[model samples]
Target: MTYIKERRRILVVEDDIDIADLVTIYLHNQNYITHVAYNLEEATKLLEQRRPDLILCDIMLPDGTGTDWIRALRKSADLPVIFLSSRQETEDIVQGLELGDDYITKPFDPDIMVARVKKRLRPAPSTSENMVATGENVWRDGWLDLHFDRFEVRVNGKEISLPAKELQLLFLMASRPGHVFSTDYLFERIWGLDNWSDVRTVMVHLHHLRRKIENTSSTHRYIITVRGIGYKFQAR
Candidate 1:
């Protein structure tokens, strides 16, 4: 049997032909399949025909605002939406974020734009059924050992206890090794979207988790902060 990876689809909605084409070219360079829509009308029609994995939308659309479109899009789909707008006002940025996952102001670096998209589309921090069945549940490094099945954590060869939430956070990061998980993603996955605890809760839990797993006196770190991004388990 042959296996082929499906390319992730991205919909770009921008009225500027130059910007739209440039964004499309950059997405294509990364091997992601992209569809361009010049306005909200075309974007809506394209969405009806084919739902893309993610969307890069402009705020100032010919038909309507990206924020309004996102409000409607949220009714049907929970996929990631990134706002690519020239609206530089604080209120505009905040509003865009409230309605979308990310907001990139105009004259944005193409590399950063692609990076944000990649981060948003990363594999969710969940162990798959196959992994569970295969018993790929143990993670061991220099001084840290985790038995996810039993929720047992050993540091420096001694068993230690962790709060339920902390244990869960550790397990998720360890499972993926080096995958970056944004605060929003981690909070949603672990605490759940309905949980009242904000993203800061994730930071607090990770801080405690690091203290527990990492050698307090040493300079080595197991959980690395990606700065402006989130955290990743650095197994070495």
Candidate 2:
């Protein structure tokens, strides 16, 4: 008996026909199922119909910028998004990275693009093995709860969607509460050396993580800044 392996589905959201075709070709060559959407409206419709494993979105779309669309998408889904845009300015890249898992500039190598898709789609560990070797899978402290196995985070009894990287950062720190993880170390640990993004990516993700986990009304902070050092998770 033989079992068929399901090909990972990827949504290619780009307005340029040439670019979209080029990307679809490369993705297909890698045995991936690809769906092409020219604008935000089409992308939205496709999203509603098919759940792709990953998305390669162009920042500038016919209906709206991908950044704005993803900002809204993040409210419900923690799906992985990679921005494929020609806008190489610092501000544009920063804004894109703030809302996206990865940003790849245009005129990118098809090989590199396929590589990134593979990286993002790589399977994570099973629930039983998702936690740190010595850390508990579930952490519940009055106001916050982190379920590592389920990749779920609840604050004040409300569940919130945390992107992949943000969840990883939270779990890493939470696994060994009180241990200060330097920005450089955190960046290297989460993003890894293969990524070309700057170290500030760590700060960006950390800011977003804090916002989701910490209540705005309360003065309490689960992740404390060490002033000159890095950050640490304080359960107390």
Candidate 3:
């Protein structure tokens, strides 16, 4: 058994030696402790040894596809899994989105891939609960501050424009700052599993929220990275 110390450990599961090597190297460069697996056996072995914070998997492997691994993992673990695939079929994409954390098509931009991974791993801090809803009123920065009954997210002493989903997600997160919630959790809360809310959908919504709130703000970045964990709403 490997004695693990760091919290932000990542697993890159790919059968292609070259691709796996490249991913492992890049993740290492980002200062994220990483482990590589070439097939189901190796991947399972690594999982048994130490659970990683997140997993990046290629859908197709020599022995099986990433879907196979995800199905198996879903039976026992909720560890985030991002699919890396050569095929860009919608069905495949949807299936993966439904099954995993995120997906990247073949010949992907390493920077984008890294950014996605980092964003998904971002952490939210402790915050009090007084949620703002849509069409109500909330202020952030020097803006309209248009939000209803959700949580108190003051942008420069005002509220900002918020969509329904964003409001719900923020409300949930703000209710408990520094509480990490996975994309799956977000989906379950916002869209519900029965409704087909998947990881990719959650990512898209988070992307929008981050752009609207965090990226534009000069101070008080509300969401911080948690490495391998999920997001937590920042307080102060």
lDDT of 2 at 221: 83
User: After superposing candidate 1, which stretches have Cα over 4 Å from the reference?
Assistant: 1-4, 122-236
lDDT of 3 by residue, 80-124 (tens): 788999989999999999999898999888888888888776442
The TM-score values for the models, in the order shown, are 0.51, 0.52, 0.49
Instruction: Tell me which residue pairs clash in candidate 2.
Output: none
Which residues of candidate 2, in runs, are more than 4 Å off? 1-4, 122-236
Q: Candidate 2, residues 1-236: lDDT per residue as tens digits?
A: 32233446788899997898689768766756567788999789878766778999999887899999999999999888999999999999999888988899989999999998888885643454333332334567668887756778888888988898999999777754554578997898789875679889988998988888897687558888888889988765
lDDT (CA) per prediction: 0.80, 0.80, 0.68
lDDT of 2: 0.80
User: How far out, in Å, is residue 134 in model 3?
Assistant: 43
